[model samples]
Target: MAEQDGAIYDRLTRVPERDWDKNAGLDALLNGAREPFVLRGFVADWPLVQAGQRSAADARRYLLDHARDRPFTVSIGPPGHDGRLFYDADMAMNFRTGTGKLGDIFAGIEASEAQDDPRTVYLGSIDIPAHFDGLDEANPIDLGDRDPLHSVWIGTRTRIAAHNDFPDNLACCAAGRRRFTLFPPSQFRNLYLGPIDNTPAGRAVSMVDFDAPDLAAHPGFVAAMAEAQTVELDPGDAIFIPSMWWHHVEGLAPFNILVNYWWRDTPAWLGQPQEALNHAILAIRDLAPEDKAIWREMFDHYVFANDGRVTDHIPPAARSVLAPLTSESAGRLRAFLLRALNR
Candidate 1:
């Protein structure tokens, strides 16, 4: 909506923001980007954006009208939370989740906005087709050939900690303004990640508080801040977050809604790397030091640093699982793991 400078958040660099590229292929740029970027007013013509521009009430009505008769899972934070959804001192989640309709959440946000200390009413990651049915077709962003799983995030004045997603994201500021502070995948070490298996959300988030980071407590964050890129997007603008890029998001307005499309560039049949990571923890984390060294070399040879000649000692046909994985072979491998893990 307006030109912005990332002078805040320790003077983080601003993400590259510009109008959509029509000459160079849009699909390729979004799917293959190694960095994050803002597509300014990319979804300006969306009905939701137009409705939101008119009034908050108009936006709320538009969503309710499009929404199906399905109960939504809502996350509610206590008053004075400053809309940060996170764990308490005991490592328990600070907020509580419950079932509610969209109207309830809208009312709660409106009510919270009026209060001295505001409660966080966040409706996060509801699948569009399941919840809103025809919203995607109605307010569409042509993703070219990509068939994505669209999800809607509606909330008010929320702080979502820095986290990465497996799939690349196209986050549209459908209604209100949003500020995203991003870190590259290489800055993973500096993010101060929490327990992987035990997270408030599915993804592990950085423990550092963006509002007031305790630098001494999290010394690594100082380094992270050096590499950070921040951007503020107004209604109708969108941002593309590449897979594994860390982002801490903020819902800036009293009544806010974001529609994001997520899709992996890989084949749908491919399993998540997280599952393999979890399995490795169970089987390998505490292995004898000497044995661990052996496994590390083996992983590097077969997976990480393999140049297709690691199995040259064996005949090509005899390589079995060492061969390049086709869809059928991947299925077989997955099935084998299920049986082995079950035993």
Candidate 2:
């Protein structure tokens, strides 16, 4: 019985196989239509290379030059911190702002560039041809981009602590091997996040001690650690991290080059009035302890419960809202949300 139980746990916790099924899981999660999913080896087409290659050098140069041209923000690591940022070119300039300063910056860039460029990182969208060479026959996932998605992340090793992004990210290592410690969105409680007011860098938190973690201090973290996944990415090896999954990245090597695609499984509702509700929550309701507590309870009631339990609460009138869970239901819910939101 013990051996069988262990096997079942392993099957549930181990990374899923990289295949269509897993990809479906990722797509479902990104669409907010399903639970967390793991897609392994989804980016096997990316070619890996060592640090000395010209491709790596070119990527680094492009990143630094782009960052220099733009008013990019930077986070300098304090002394004795494991954070260090270095670029092959001296053109890389550092910009530091107080917490929450970069929010407007991120909003502005996304507004102007038609792409997400939070954290002052240079992100080349996936539709540009300059980024992908042999993608024609690669059976690539159609992310509606004519160009290959790429980005250059230049930051101190400890600059970005830990957080999750809204869109699914496929990051390719070009110059350095970054050690990524990933936790599913379900582990958010264990992370102990910072303030949400901080923009670009949102809700900073460290999942584990760099040198030593006091397990006693955070007992819940032990379960989080048990479910934690680690990947050391070298040049050419890309990691497909599902949307909203918490991650901490340590730049194991200097001049780290990373190209990534931030793709959403669903279309974004731009210029929607519903955004006002989000703003109101952040600006007002979130401040009141009673209101916040009520909101938290609502989330726990509707969002955190198992699918079986929560699905029952979804009314037939709102059944369409739950249709994202399956392809058969997506159209109904999509239309419903679109109409309901008047978007």
Candidate 3:
């Protein structure tokens, strides 16, 4: 429990190890979670996690033995930069990045006492199959019909600022440990979002520094953190983060490695809702306030509510655009939107 000096009543709800299994219980929670919760022994048996139980060096060797000769991009920052990677005053990215051999980078990590001095040097997302051949065989988890998009993240004592991902993520702490402070998407307004087009860690991150809060500068972050749920993970534990949930990640050990499986709940035919949101910002953001309110109601009726009664008045045969979206209808709608945008 990473609580304040004498604070009581941890914000996160923790469920014990024996309560949930990986199949139905885990799937149900991932599908319909309203708040973040921790499953105690979700991945305690992974070989990587087992190696980590011995020592951090042992875990590093295990992963390195499986890796290929592929080069990986690394993020580097000076010691005492306090672990948080972000944009500096000049709007330049705080951390420097370069590509190098996986073995060479790991050697550097092993040689340095990163926890004592604290430099940010890590690989963000290395494709598991591409870099570590047959690694998935060592640690298998069922994602069912959806073949997950898997990646490996290895780094030193570093912190990734609050950010949201597009797909649902299952992050397994295979080596070292981590603490995740998560907030719901509804707190987007209070999170102090950065530039959408340019980002440090491949996504729009929050400007607020949770480790050292500048309360005067970002007053809204107080509200956001108040709603946050913090979960500390040891090696072998895993967390399922639903899509669009904002999370700030901290690597709690000198050398850290995590494997993540990303998948969408919806079928492949459905387009990314974030793309539609970007288009909406372009088309509807500057409208008159009254017109904006009317459009909001229209959107609620069409997209949010899913109220079949509103469209029951129209005959099914005549309901072309408003019909239930089957694969064929979705394809037609996509084509129609493309044509409209092209004009």
Candidate 4:
């Protein structure tokens, strides 16, 4: 398959798998390396997985019984989109979104199955605790004291284009199967990134379609594919995606649901480095080549390789801007940026 298609490279890496247990040693897995890894049998004993093993109807019942009849957001698209939700020619979403009850979506799924229809419905990223009250208690992953924000994605054979999330993620398969094609942050240049301000998804997505990639249009995508790794997860299986790792997700089965936990290890005061990069581009990108070269050295010395000695040459009392970055210091920086921008 890889040889025939230039988008699917033959020498792609594989994600390491770990067995699920009460003591899964997640801290070691998370803290040691920022690489993606899977945990087999992670949520194997959850009621949702058991129900999925029985039948789609059983899984639907388990969810409806837990979440009740509350209205949730659902996205609908024609088969032309091929279950891939993304932007069209005018930068508008190819699909449309509407709020509806969960039962309506499940019924739509069943009806579509019976009729062999091409229209698809998706209830993506619904808050578990807010919508489904008692569901979290029934199925828990035991992530220790750190309470991660939980969300669920329910759909039928959907594909999400390659995009990166800011927080570290644990995506657990509750029902059906999923395939993830992951690329490291370094592959960003070859991915053909789309608009930053306007996006179909929350983040800037790659214009190249993974399933039917047009190599002629996006030649650099071949290089990105060479560095890509694909992983398939069954019900009860889970995968950890480190922050800023680009991933393309595909839900394989007719009826599927994924529960994911997202959390960040860094302090909130540190903020997102992506924002800083955007600001740097605005402030420094248009400078003369010589000026830019000089700024690069300044950044390297002060920002990248400053191991506590970059500002050591300056008196501690006078190093107000270069001082240690505490929450108060961050607030002061924010105020300075606000004032500079307003001017």
Candidate 5:
């Protein structure tokens, strides 16, 4: 991340690009992709893309016209930090957020763009259907039975630290140029993660600065770099990021806008894995080694096994929680956990 910036970018594998027209629909493509891929000119026909292609002003107008005139949250990062929205020395957020109409926010962003070193202005994870009127109908991807959480991201030139999310992402660059540096889920140990609960965003992000990583302090990052995949997306290009894959994003253009879809492969009622992790940390993390080992064996038997070892001992009707979980069973399990934790 020092003298090796160009080398790192050059050595990394570019994310493969696919043709959306030539291939199957989005859901099918995603089901097969298992990894991140680019779709060049995927949404070139969309009104949003055409508007942005004409001018950023046109794009802003298009969005404002479609928007419901509701106040939207914007993240404003102070200048002098190289446009990176991260933390200060005290681990507090480096950016302040305020809500404004899209037009006002875009005006502020435009003003900032004129500055030599502009303030980082970002509007992230905005629910498209809730705030925008008829845009979802006008510009839509056929996700085919998968009702994803459609969202939009708007920002000036900025850097977002590497982070993972629970739901897989399909990110479409509606306006401006953007670069993504992605790492596999296995690179967890090398990414030098920040505090889990107190994150800049909801998801935990890598503490390492991609532009200038301190390799000596974090030697494992070198291994992470070896596995990195970097790709730059132009307007109308899209990328598929598998759930839990670490990604560092850069808004290359002065004004950038992205539309993304997020959804889990698992059903909604199954419960969040992160909560289970927190509960495990509370219950098992500090246990004595021998006790921990026993608990690990118990977990393997109960939660993480496929040998039919559990069912071999129990009858069909008696295998209540052990059986395939449905919405009802998951609800019951949550209720049981709450009662147990409270006791």
Candidate 6:
């Protein structure tokens, strides 16, 4: 019950106690619950067979056997400087030594060393049939040519700072537990994002510190912390974190194993327009406070019009620009933007 961080972390309150058959498919679990939902004890059919049974030795062997053959990248945590830790590039490089054995490489390492090691491992395009032997069908998610079923081994009690990914991710634990802190899109203002356009891999600054955050430095974080929600996941259970929701994950136990599936939606490309809106904010909206205020007012007129007749405000000539999306129409719009940019 101890609160170590600024955010509140707790276990699943409503654990389903029934022991249903282990071979149950994921259709019910995936489709029954709506978006932004959490379910306890949802285990994947294929991986659950070897769950808790796979030893650290087996995992190490698997990683070494596949390291040179695949597009796998290892994250060995970050580096330490003046007692404050940052991601280290050297430790990540050490994985290349000694055929990458877990015991040989990670033995006698302090928590700070593990945290700074850049050996964060990611196996890209894992062949499903090759990885998980004797699986009938692929999980509904498509992970390119790589296996949709993948595993993540967290060696230390590591912290994954706040960020969001493109696809909907379903993370199931095979060993140990993890604590997840989540915030909806509306809470972005509270999250205090570092850079609007930087990739997640490149973001180096953390928005908030749970142990001892400087309230004076980040005044808005206080309001955001009040609205945050947390969930702790146990072994044999899974959590679905939808697209665009900011999440911060912490490995609570050592030798943790997580198998996750990342799936994209057909309309996943909606973010392109949102990215354009962000660019518009930078190019036009942020130029002057008065112009920003005017743009906000106009946006309200278009988005919040109760009469459902804001289309009336658009001029006849500009009507085509706002027309419904079609392949041909989209092409014309792209051409128009290109011409405008070139001019």
Q: Highest lDDT: which candidate?
A: 5
In candidate 6, position 155 carries an lDDT of: 51
lDDT of 4 by residue, 5-74 (tens): 6344345677788654567546656674589899988889998899999988899999989985678999
Error of 6 at 322 (Å): 2.4
Best by TM-score: 5
lDDT of 1: 0.85
lDDT: worst 10-residue window of model 5: 1-10
For residues 242-343, write the lDDT of model 1, one tens digit per residue.
999999998888878999999888998888998888888888889999999999998888889887678878898887677877798789888998899888
Task: Looking at model 3, report the run of 10 residues with the lowest lDDT sum.
Answer: 1-10
What are the clashing pairs of model 2? 83-158, 84-157, 126-147, 126-148, 126-149, 127-146, 127-147, 128-147
How many steric clashes does model 1 contain?
A: 0
- Minimum summed lDDT over a 10-residue window in model 2 is located at 84-93
Q: Candidate 1 clashing pairs?
A: none
Where does candidate 1 have its weakest 10-residue lDDT segment? 1-10
lDDT of 2 by residue, 1-343 (tens): 0212334233334333244443443343344332333344444443323322454445443333323222333344323333422221242323343322223333433343333222333221223234333432332444443233444454323334457877677665655566666788888788665445433343345534534456677677777767777665665555667777777666654345455666564545322233444555655584679878887776666556636665676776676544335554656555765696674
The runs of at least 3 residues in candidate 2 whose Cα sits more than 4 Å from the true structure, single-residue gaps closed, are 1-72, 84-150, 155-159, 270-343
lDDT of 3 by residue, 32-71 (tens): 5545566666778888888888988888888878888878
Model 6 gets an lDDT of: 0.51
C-alpha RMSD of each candidate structure in angstroms: 2.8, 11.8, 3.2, 2.9, 1.8, 6.8
lDDT of 3: 0.80
Candidate 6 lDDT at 158 equals 53
Whole-model Cα lDDT of every candidate shown, in order = 0.85, 0.48, 0.80, 0.84, 0.88, 0.51
lDDT of residue 307 for candidate 4: 66
Tens-place lDDT digits, model 5, residues 291-314: 999999999888888458878788
